[model samples]
Target: MVELAICSSNFTDQLALLSFKSSINFDPNNVLSNWTQETDFCGWVGVLCSRRRQRVTGLILRSMGLQGTISSHVGNLSFLRVLDLRNNSFHGHLTNEIGRLLRLRLLVLAENNLTGTIPPSFGNATSLKIIALARNYICGRIPTELAQLPKLQIISLSDNYLTGPIPSGLFNILSLSYLLLDANQLNGQLQAFPNNSLQFLDLRFNELSGPIPLLVATNFLISHNKFTEIPLALCNVSSIKILDLSHNSLSGVIPQCLGNFSNVLSVLDLRMNDFHGSIPTSFVEGNKLRSIDLNGNQLEGKVPRSLATCRHLEVLDFGNNNINDTFPYWLETLPELQVLVFQSNKFHGPMGSSKTQLPFPKLRILDLSHNEFSGFLPTTYFKHFKAMTIINETVGLRYMGESYYHDSVTIMIKGLEIELPGILTIFTTIDLSHNKFSGEIPNVIGKLYALRLLNLSHNNLVGNIPSSLGNLCSLESLDLSSNQLSGKIPSQLTSLTFLAVLNFSENHLEGHIPRGNQFETFDNSSYNGNLALCGFPLSKECEDNKTQLHPTPMLHKEDDPTFACGFCWKVVQIGYGCGMVLGLVMGYIMFLIGKPKWFVRIAEGEQQKKGKRSHKGGNRNGGRRK
Candidate 1:
């Protein structure tokens, strides 16, 4: 019984020592409640012991959200092979005494708030194979002594503020498969390293600039930097499956040789760059290509026709370019196509044929705004577009009559005005303002229950404002300004509680303005250009309503049709016509005053020839006289 007491005392001391080594606060929850001196350490939470329970073999407390400083007493666990406290909030520097763990194989303290330099003594852990300290506040240069670990396979120090060049000896670890040093202040060109056996390598979002070195990693991500062009060395890595070089200053044409890696290449993102010229046709030829993003560039010409063949393609973003062509008909054939963004391009024509099925049936988001697309969009386009933010505003339209225009027109996007389709339902809408669309406002627009944003400003639309628009409960923005709309302001429009922006200015609207709600909040500028509109904001009241027998000018439709045809129109026409004639006359006068440089040179040449002739004549006459 005396020997048993001694053994228990020794075990308690060992347990105390183990607790001091790790930087962890006691779990308030009962997760580690069993950890006590009375209980065997083997039965403790996150503690593993050997078969005899004489030594702790492993301490795995990953993702336990453990906080507090790591205790140096962790080294007391002499037989510990693995210590994983990853994905925790543990702060403070890693204890330098961790080197005492002679049998340690894996040490991962990633995704923590641990600050301060990595302990140099970590290099002494010769048995260590994997060390991941990524996503931390650890600063200072990577220790060169870490290269001494002969069996190191993975080292991730990404998303940290570690500065200075990467240690050269680190490349000597031929067994290294994954190295992530991105999102750091590390600067310098990538030097040569062992190309074989590497699977994942990311050096992106760093100050490091220069041509990418020849690497054989299967997954390569080097985006959001100052790269000037495509790294030629990257093309040689035929085994590369995922390559991302996005959001950089890379310019020039996209290299066509990328298609050579058709077997392994799956995802390639080169978005948000200065990459100009046309997309190479070879990219579409790759049979295994799944995703390609070339958005936010100056790429011109038509999209490659071969892209349709890439059956597995999911996301294709070609927005914000000078691409001038019709929508790729073959895109509808892609089975897995999900996101197709062609916004701010030069694409024109309707979405699809009236009889044919909707293109991209499974498409979730389709942004085709700021284009030259015209005509009444087929109802089928909105049938499958249950969840989409289609922006067909007419701000980019440069031509007239190309857009859909009928006798009764309603709804406007941008500046181009267009007629709303009869079968259109739900929240979708058409913006066709600023175009040549004419005729009276259509009453059919009230049937669309889902119409949210209706803009018909800056057009030639005529007739009275439709009161039926008040039925749209989901209407948010209603713009009908710069048109020929007349009649009293619809009082029912006050029911639009969701209406945020309402513009009806520059129209021929008259009569007492509606009161309360959005109207009261809006300034007089919204109801401007309507000379007959009288209310609290404009004036006191109409003259006829002020007194019992007050004589007021009869508001005759014939005498004052609310149309201003005064000297302003004649003066504008005369000014425009005279301005054109004056421009021509001034151009001719400037041409007369200015002499061509070539003509001046010819006159100077002639004068020089005459002088030479006189000199020759004088010399010849003197010789003859002699």
Candidate 2:
């Protein structure tokens, strides 16, 4: 009887496992193909049966492209301890029957298409330790029953549609270490809670308002919130590193003591805020700072020279601010500095540089547009971008530091918000537009063969478009418009086959526009404002001297209105000239003929008639006298 009971229990487990496989409508990899009854239930894939009694204990189906709703029979696996379906295409609400799994501990459904809210029956899983449903479509307020899990250590539901204030009970979880609820509809002011062993907390991209709580955490990001002030208590957290409070309504002077974590802080991003006054200059030596982004803020005054002490600094962006300092050539000393953006500020003076300093060797992205910067293009500075002059696919700079702020940063440059999608170093670019840069686009820029974008528009640059620019085989977008550049469009530009966006508009370019390759794909807009430029897209045709051969005089189509008007004007002019010549010829011929006989006879008769009339009048007078 005991053996029969055991067999019955094992059969029931197998049936439940089979039901779970049946629910999977699509399994591209055939990961569940071997889960049939023909095979022993213990040999099934992703099924870890217990040794003593044949029963499923864990089910990990991550990244297998599995589809369809999770089976309700999954709850029948009463001995299940772990259920991981992360990074899959699983949809539908979690079965409420999952509450029957009393031994469940870790539940990870992250990066899936699962919908519906957290099953309230989840409260029955008292032994749960971790619950992660991030990057899903789950909605509804977080079930307060989660607070019952005293052993829970991590709960992440970020990138979901969850709304309402976070449960206050979650803040009091003594064993909780990480809590992520970002990128959701979660609103309401955060409430203060007593400290626990929590370390990492991210609540950004939400509508959370009010003051920040005096919490102790290692990595904290609350940006895109409505906090009006930085709590002084944050400085007290000695273990803090990577504090991002950007895109908030927080006003007032930044606390000087905020730099107290120089020893631990690696990234301090306070961009897109209302913080005014000079930036705190309390950075000391031995600082481990890697990035400092204060763009789109109202901060004034100069960049603190003390920042030069951070040898490990990689990205320093202070664009779109009220900063009134000259070019900080002193920053060239930082060995790892890669991205330097200072666009749309009050920065003035010649593009200065250290006389004997080494160029920013690793620098790939350099943007200094829309400033009071004057003087010639800094060719020497550009030549030193060793990282951008070459192409290397092995380097992972394309993927590095992109999501350090969770999303693209927006700066109000040119009175419009511009989003820096990612700080990808491999996508090299140079933007010096909207400045007073003059002279010429230096030939050295062509040496940046790996450059993808170059913007020199709205400057005072003069001279012919450099033919050497053809050497940039990888150049994609070139903007040289609104400049004083004159001369023929270089034919060598036809070599840029990868060029997608070309702008020579608003320049003094003359002669036939380049044809063939990528140049042929450009339209009139690319050549607009250049009255001297003529091509297929323009109404004006190139002069015969500019083309290889003169165009033949072809008859215009009758449907062409311009041709019709031109033809009519020519006919009228020719008719008028012919009529004047004919009239003069007829008059000269009549004068040479002495006078027609009829005209002479008529004149003689008129004189004779007048004589007769005079005689008749005299005769009548004599008769009256008699």
Candidate 3:
């Protein structure tokens, strides 16, 4: 009788498991195919049982592409301790019966389509330690009962629709370490968090406002909030390493107290704020700041030369500010410097570098546009742009931004100034437009095959387009308009198959536009101000007599009469050759005759006619032909 009872209990657990498995709408991985009565429950996949009790203790179905909702029958597995179903397509409200699992400790339903509110009854499961339901469609404010779990260490409810102020009791959990509640509709001022042991806290992209609490976090991201200034208590969090307080209306000068964490600070982003006054020059070297973005601010004064001490600096943007100073050439000393932006600033003077060592050797994005920069472009700088010379496809495809922390930059790509958070490392560009820069563009710029944008418009640049520009096969946008550039456009530029935006307007360019690849897509606006340029998109035919006779090629249209072959073409070619030979013979006979009487009379008549015109001009303005 005892053996039969044990068998009946085991069979009851199997029935519950099969009932939940049947609820699945899709199981592309066939994870539940072996969950049948023919096999022992312990031998089934994703079902772990005890060695003696034959009861399920763990059920892991992470990233199995499983779909459908949880079944209430899962509560029958009284011994389950771990239940993981993350990174799947599971939907529908979570079964309230999950609260029946008194022995459950780990419950991860993250990265799914789960909806509905957290069951208040979940408080009965006092054994729960980790509950990660992040990146889902779950609604409603977090249940107050969740704070009752004495052993709960982590609660990740980020990237969801959870609303209302975070429960103040949730902060009372001393065992919690990681609390990420960002990218949601949660509101209200931040409440005092009593748990001092929390290490990672991210409340970004929320409706949080008011002063922040004094929390010592290793990685804290509270940006995109309504805070008016950096928390004064941030000075107390000596353990802070990654701190992003950008995109807020934080006014007033930056706190000098930030220098206190010189030994622990690695990433400090204070971009898109209202901070004014000179940047603090109290920085030290051991901080390991790899990225510093202070763009779109009211900052003035020279770039703190003391920043040279940070040898690991990779990205620095101070564009769109009132900063008035020469270029910070000393930044080149930092080996990892990759992005430099100083556009729309009061920075002036020629950007010529004389150091033997290449300045900004690893720079991939250089934006000095809309400034007062004068004189010729720094050709020497283009020659040493080794980073842009090599294509880094993997950097944009795999790693969207810098390692460890996200790197943001505001640049004028394709024409408008846009801010890109987590900018891809492969976005190679050079924007020197709307400046007073003069002289010919250096041929060395063509060597940067990885360059995606090249904007040199609205400058005083002269000389013909460099034929070497054809080497940039990956270039997508080329803007050289509104300059003094003369001569015909380089036919070699047609090789850039990826060219989507081209502009050569308001220049002195002439001759036939290239007819292949991207050139065929350009409209008359691309060559508008160049009155001498004529092609398929322009109604004005080339007036060169040579082209009129031979019609070399108007965009090399195949249907042109020159490309036809027939009796008329053959006769024309024969007549042209004969006329050339006969003209040479006649010229020889005239030379032998030594000035024929008819020729002399004709020459004298032409000279007399010229003398009459000269006399008329002299009579009109006293011999000065105005």
Candidate 4:
């Protein structure tokens, strides 16, 4: 009778596995090729059976490219503890029968095409510990029944269509640790979270609103919400590490005690808000801060000098503010600093000489545009940017952030305020446009072989375009428009095959525009103000003997339109779109930055009007001056 009972249990599990195999409409990986009657169900791929009962306990088929609905018959495995089908193409509603798995401990079905509401029946799985249903199309409110699970620890339902206020009971779970509900359509005000074991809580990119709740997690990401005001109670959370409350409607002065949290806090992002007040200046020494972003705010006063105490600082942005101050040259002492942005602010005065031998040794991006900075461009600092001069193969490729956080910043690119969701380490640029910097293009800039964009437009810079700039083989966009620069468009510049956006217009530059490589793709707008630049893109033709043209002192170079066709279509086509200048610019940036999603969004944004060739004046306060 015992043997008969074992055979009965084996038959039940075997029938369940067969039902699962039948439900799969597509199995490109042939994962179920061995799910045949000749072989025991225990011997199938991803199947795990116990030694005693020979019943299925685990079924992990992650990234197997499997498609179709999950079979409800899977509930027959009464002893099953894990069911991982993540990173596949499984579609249809989640089988409610999964709730029948009384022994279920982990249920992972993330990164799939599964649609429909989450199965409330999940509440019945008393033994459940973790539920990972992120990166799916699951909709409907989270079941309050989830709170009943005594052992539930992690609930990851991010990147889905889940709507309605988060179940209040879920927050009350004492064992809950990581609760990620970001990138959803969830709404409703949050209740003050009680002190428990919550460690990481992400509610970003949602419609959640109401007064901010008391914080308890170490990594709290609640950006892209409708929350208003930063409560002083938040400053009391000394254990918090990463706090990102950006892109919200928060107002009022930032809690001064936030600066004191430097010892434990690592990431502080509060951009795109209406907070107006002097920045906190109590950053203590031996702090752990790595990124600080306060862009697009109404704050005034000089940058806090105490920020220099952050030894691990990597990214700092203070753009679009009313803060009046000179260059914070002291920040160069930070060895890990990579990105520094101060665009559209009250920062004035010249960037004086570097205090250290290699100032900003790891600086990859420097944007000081739209400010009142005067005097010559920081030439000494350019040579010391060893990080941008060469690619660091040792680090491989990665974004500038910690494992749980990604550093972001906003900088002017192609006249648009582009937001970088995550700054890539290899992405390098230098924007000093709309400033009063007067001098020739620094020759040392050519040493930055990895530099992708350089903008010095709307400045008082004079002298010829540096021939050494040809050494920047990776340069994609070069803007020197509306300047007093005069000289021939260097023929060596034709070597920059990746050059896409060229705006030397409104400059005194004279001679034939380089014809070969990416230069042939640019329109007359690139050389409009120069009036002297003659080439295929321009109306005037270069003379065979005379170096200058009659109408304007145009440039001279051999015309070769053949090489222009070799440029990548993906990049070249972006320039032709009438209202996609933002996408075109962002795409090129994403292509270099190594992010796929941003590259996909490159097909959007405001268009660049080529018909408007009027010169832009240097009026920083008012709107664009023609």
TM per candidate comes to 0.65, 0.82, 0.83, 0.88
Off by over 4 Å in 1: 1-27, 30-34, 63-65, 168-172, 260-263, 284-286, 348-356, 378-380, 384-626
Alpha carbon RMSD to native, model 4: 8.5
lDDT of 3 by residue, 1-626 (tens): 98898888888889999998988989998988898889887989898898887889998898888989988899988999999998788889988999999999999988777889989888889999899997677879888898898888888886677788888888888888888887677778777676877877888777778777666667778877777756677777788777778777888888876765656777777887899999878777676777777878899898998788777778788888899998777777777888888889998889876475776778888999889998989888898888887654334222223333467666554455555444555567899999999999988787776677799999999999987777775577789999999998877676666677789999998887766767778888788899888876778766652332222334323222222211223433333222221232243244233423222212222212111112111111110100
Candidate 1: tens digits of C-alpha lDDT, residues 403-437: 11100112233343222211111223344444333
Clashing pairs in 2: none
Model 3, position 232: C-alpha lDDT score: 73
Residue 334 of model 2: what lDDT? 82
Off by over 4 Å in 4: 545-585, 588-626
| True lDDT of residue 14, candidate 3 | 94
Put the candidates in TM-score order, highest first: 4, 3, 2, 1
Model 4: per-residue Cα lDDT at residue 274: 84
**Model 3, C-alpha of 316: deviation from truth (Å):** 0.7
- How many clashes (backbone N, Cα, C below 3 Å) per candidate? 22, 0, 0, 8
Q: Which 10 successive residues of model 2 have the least lDDT summed?
A: 617-626
- CA RMSD (A), model 1: 22.9
Put down candidate 2 lDDT per residue, 280-366, tens digits, no spaces.
Answer: 888888988888888888889998888888888888889888999888888887889877889889998887655545778788778
| TM-score-best of 2 and 3 | 3
Ordered by lDDT, highest first, the candidates read 4, 3, 2, 1
